[model samples]
Target: MTAAEGHGAMTAAVGSGATTVVEGRIAGTASSARVTVRGGRIHRIERLTGDAAAVIVPGLVDAQINGYEGHDVNDEHVDGGTIRRMAAALWARGVTTFLPTVITAEEERIVGSLRAVRDARALHPVLGHAVHGAHVEGPHLSAGDGARGAHDPARMRPADVAEFHRWRQAAGGIVRIVTVAPEVAGAVEYIRQVSLECLVALGHSSANAAEALAGADAGARLSTHLGNGVARTLPRHPNLVWEQLADPRLSAGFIADGHHLDAAAFGAMVRAKGVDRSLLVSDAVALASAGRPPGDYRTPVGGEVTLHEGRRLTLRGSELLAGAVKTLDECLSWAVAAAGIPLADAVRMASENPAALLGLTTRGRLQSGAAADLTVYDDEPSIGRTPANVTIVAGTCVHRGPSDAGLAELGEIPEELR
Candidate 1:
């Protein structure tokens, strides 16, 4: 069962014209307050007497996601059910908005996945609100080794505007972002045209500095998982990473799960791009979650993959990493713990930066005018204390802890999980 269904019924009735009050400490602070929600927007926030009850912040947004927990969006048989479950699972974490990424696949298969996401949104209110759109990540990428990453080399093809139109139509015009290889034939022209329809991003490229800049000039505005999609070795003077970092036009997405990028590199790159131009994306797959045993697993997209020690996932027999196995919530904690980034900056990368890049002004912020989408933790996230987090969407309480227990689990009594 999806987390929504597994949690029984929602605590707040939808469209009931009711006001909901949430008591919490503003996340990253020690102050306590009560937030009032009405008509799906935060009505007011007033200080409350007593210690801070919970840790609250704007709902997290993920730009690139493949799957999470046991639900695989790119599985061969993915459908509306898969999208629904994926949304439910992510909501159980702190992610309130995300782009369900459909990676390198055949034309028909890709269309099918897009249609499924579109249909799921139409059929379910919670799922629809949580999903922003589809992030089409491939079929137009570098075919060379190392750069290709987990995508099949044979499936990599030149960018084609016509194919993108077809995918967009299949997704009911909800295709928000598309990733392209800057060096591929017709890439510049393809980016110019497709970007008019949706945001075009650069990734999986075996291109030099000039071509990368050319792609940006062609209206490519984001770099997909900047550090991980290119060759491991590069010339010291000029490379795609340096060019993308130096250019201010492109906002970059990062898989900050500690496996796709090391702490030092992640810190340096974030510093270069600044928190406003940098976003944290899971780039996660089916096996993604907090903890899973080390073993061999089969997936339709990656074929044979292995979950190694320390939550690292890789191709069964290769040194190249496969995909991220952590959620945006976990990645936020990781950034603060390992990268030396401030907690507020890391949260902005996970929420505000991505929402602004996508033009979603109503989300990714905590204020009276913002939408009532929030994530609440029982306590601050640190090495010793991991507290339970609860998700609130449009004044509705969706997911609590594992057993889905009492309101006291929100930290008045004790810290549970964060």
Candidate 2:
């Protein structure tokens, strides 16, 4: 069989030299181009004259990930080793950078988990580069039943800036994003203060439209999985959903996985928020066991959960969603093919836009001088049994995939990477 048929052993050269070359059509444009990478950055890009079926796009940046491939971030005993493994699992699936999310756990667990993530980054350069920071998604959320979703309502509490400082101190300033409920006591002030150092977001709330806008005015610039985190039933008119979409100051993060939103609903939201203001987030939890059969399972994060026939995860006895199960790359494909989103826009939502939201100017982009984080789809991007091509994290060829089985076969990670 030829090299191309082998899924890129000879087709793509990773670590080829201080400088490497890749030629393809940039996503969202008709122009085919050649991009040169030197010393972990894009050195140059030039238009190429050829028939190139390959599509080169920015690397995917997932804003919220609780865990992946059975590594649970919120597990009671989570440590640096868990984070190290999760980063590698994400890399194989084409997620170059992700925010390891910690939800409404106890105060001790939250800080301990953040410290572990910081230690993981300190101990491994690859993980340090791959993990942007920790996203604290709870403890500041509403305690109300329906609005709290799968989170333990008993663990919910009013927003406290003192505890927030402890989180920053523990993570070595790695707490980059925080999600809160505007209606909660002290939340607006918390947003006002934390916004100076972090990306303040609003989520898991029972806030009315005016209250939601107040949070946005208080420097809450992003919405966490906007359409999904609120109460199951809300006033038909003037709800947080409509208010969030209409507000120009806030960028909305969306989960384009099939179970989250159908094509028409996703299309409407994208149009409402405008393609430029919308971003994609997986909101993934640790359930991606490659080839692990779908069935019932007990988990520490969301007790008594079931991984269903079609990759949707839910509480064992209820219709409520436990958490997302799809990877960011797969979410992008569904947005384009099933959700009626334009491929270019979907790519941006999955990559560039999310990076920009978090203030990472050089990440999730395709340009000269940007970090050489990239994904090359063999043809046009699509989801199948394989990743379909090569993925580079900081110019290091990390994934050349046929299946996720590569993780076990890659042998022991060198000490530095460990």
Candidate 3:
């Protein structure tokens, strides 16, 4: 029986307009809800009286997820099976839809990972796989060692539209987001080229205000991991981060995992960019499982990075910091309480904001005719603790709490199972 049915039906009648009533704490308000979902879209929302005073929020849309659940997308050995498995794992983590981010790797490896994601998407067109698109972090980026971060300096270079076109084809037309350094030669034109077809992001570069704005003018809509993938000691004024955050035309994405940026920095960026233009991405690596154990994490371009502590990891760049440990949910929490962002606004950053930034049509909002993606969480209004328990992708439960079992698995082909 479903969780609600398992508790025995205690019907609380509402307007006949209701189809499926979801009871939970609404935003930061007192626990209440009678959210109706029909035809895989939220039909209506109303306050309801119920005992399980939980909260219902929109499911998260992560534009960047390099790896999770013991599977790294950058790893050369990643296959269709691994991609499907990873997609399933993310769904359980409250991600309704996500871009399978393949970070800097050899050209061949990037091509392979893109193909794997494409195959997985094709195999499961429904939200089961939840592969809305693919995010290519890049080999075509800055050459400066510091700017390149964990990306192999050798692989990093100026933009080449021909190479990107080849990679896009190999991705089975599933490539939607591509990160490029506007400072690189030919990158401006290349941004226009790729942005014509996909969402281009400015990342791993040392572009100043003029160059960064040029990228935005060239149709670069998002900045990948805003504060994490750039030079360490940027000039105090008019750097890429400041420019991107200040430009109203451009949208910014954050790792939100406090490790990516301190509370102060994170709050400043949010202030500059505004919640409407800011998005939460879990630039999570392959070892994002519980128990912050140190492990070797392989990247698409670089060989591996050793997770050393909660915030530190050894990567290709001698002094570059690696990916973080926190989930997108945790990131949202920090943004809300610690960063002093409103709960509704923080939810937008984790959901609607990313969807708008990435140009996703029917996601991010819990409104009628939108994709039925939802994140159910336990909320402590007093302490402002909101932890996600279940993630529903396309109206089907993907991840559940320890209390929930027998939840449906996504992208699992019965024929392939023994």
lDDT of each: 0.80, 0.80, 0.71
- The residue pairs that clash in candidate 2, if any, are none
Ranking by lDDT: 2, 1, 3
Give lDDT: candidate 2, residue 369: 85
RMSD of 1: 6.6
Model 1 gets an lDDT of 0.80
Off by over 4 Å in 1: 1-17, 382-388, 402-418
Q: Which candidate number has the best lDDT?
A: 2
Better of 2 and 3 by TM-score: 2
* Candidate 3 residue-wise lDDT, 1-418, digit = tens: 1122212222222212223345565565554655566656776665445544456778778888887777877776887777777777766566777888887766888899888887776665553337787898887777675677777777676788998889877776788899998988899999998888888999988788799999999989889888877877789887888888888888889877666788899989888888778888988777777676766656543456777666455674344666665667777877876778888888788888888766776788866677777766655342113335555566554555643322222322233310
lDDT of 2: 0.80
TM per prediction = 0.91, 0.92, 0.87
- What are the C-alpha RMSDs, in order, of all predicted structures? 6.6, 4.4, 4.9
- The TM-score of candidate 3 is 0.87
